[model samples]
Target: MLDARREDLGRMLRAWRMARDPAALPGPVPFRGHRTYLTQLDMALLLGVSERWYRALERGEDRGYAREMIDGVARILALPPRQATALYRGTGHQPPRRPAGGVRPDAALLDLLHQQRRVSWICDQAWDVLAVNAVGARHCPWLARADANVMTWAFSAEARYQLRDWEARWAGSLLGRLRLAWQRWPDNARLDEVVRGVRREPGVAELWERTADTRETSDDAARPMYFPLVAPDPVDVRVAAYGRFGDTALRWLVLTPEDPTVAFP
Candidate 1:
């Protein structure tokens, strides 16, 4: 592992570059002396960026570097797990996660999810299921599936039978939130995978193309849904949106029954 002891991003990057064997990399050799390390210009050429742009980025003078560019640098430098995360943070970013739906909720988060008396579910930024409360599980047993995603299910044909009004109450609003997530974390591979999954279903691609529903949250509005085996009747719910420990990467949702006399069945 390369020494990331240096707090400076440029220094860390330089160290990583120097640690690499120039001959091992697939690139034209630099003409200069020692032949021990790849130069900044080499990094720039590999990244498809201008030398000035890469220099500014290395010097920490550039704060607006794109996620793809950072990812490219990480791949090119072959940064170790810890060092990769550090590089991302030093560049005012977060490291990309492995595969889609790989997020594991910690004990505290799992406890928080189980504590909710109301129908609730916890998901990662990609809307992949992390935890589903027992109450929620009974209401929609499909959530118990190993690879369940609320957004993906919402757009599926089976969801039409479960939701009250699949298009207006759920589709537009739900798709809006999905689109918003895509906009917020375009570099998230899992999130991109989720989007692709949704669009593959008939009519979803057309709906996604529409610009009318960009609202991130699904609160205030009625989210009418059905639990056929459990409730039989459609339940009007108010969707409460939240993030775990102020981290947007994890989303917590509580579906509160609207009527005071009514409770989740």
Candidate 2:
């Protein structure tokens, strides 16, 4: 039973991570592979501690890393504000509250979201890839053009190829975002289902046990992130866009490439 709950928490963590927007996080862009722009050693510096001790915290070996330390990590990871608070309070012990709504996209918003440059979509707080624009279809091969779960893309073999730095960068960022979405609108059944689906993957399952503290602060200068474009270049092409609430009932998201030279064509 403990193991089951651990897995459930892991899934919730995974879902939450996928829902975050890097622009909302803090810190400079990190070299790929470090968690939320900080290495275990960097975390030590942030905590005024040492790498070996920080490694223990990361390994889940420390029974008591100060609330401040956990919060520090969450901030570094750019966890959605609520998730960060909850994480600090819970000491990495809780999963997000279950989401309440189903995955539904507004028709007009869908049209607009697709019309944008790259690819974008809408999912209720559950992290499902409820919808995607043509650019998403064209660029993000790992994500299903039809009903999809961002978590699926995170865990898929294709995702590793597409994301390149899945463990440190994409996985943590995505999960942190997803958690924020859940915080904003928990009790969404569709989001829960998506969370469950992605938790089945091994790498995701492993990371979920640690904590939901993963941040990625993307500045205006930074770009949207995408993958599977012309290969040889490992970093997924950067894409950017924002979610605009058309009304209480609908949201519009536009995904566009950060680099104008790299046209969608």
lDDT values for all models: 0.72, 0.51
Q: Model 1, 93-191: lDDT tens per residue?
A: 777776322445677767777787777888888887666877787777656544567888888899987888887777887888788888889888888
Q: The CA-based lDDT of model 1 is what?
A: 0.72
User: lDDT by residue for model 2 over 1-265, one digit each (tens)?
Assistant: 2344434444544455444443322211223343432345544554456778766554435356664455445544446556554555445544334321233555566666656665565544444445555565566643333234566666778767656566755666667665666566555655665677777877677777664674556522333244536334543344343454543333344444445556665
lDDT of 2 at 77: 49
**Predicted candidate 1, C-alpha RMSD:** 16.3
TM-score of each: 0.59, 0.50
Off by over 4 Å in 2: 1-103, 142-145, 214-231, 235-241, 246-255
Weakest 10 consecutive residues of candidate 1 by summed lDDT: 23-32
For this target, which candidate reaches the highest TM-score against the unseen true structure? 1
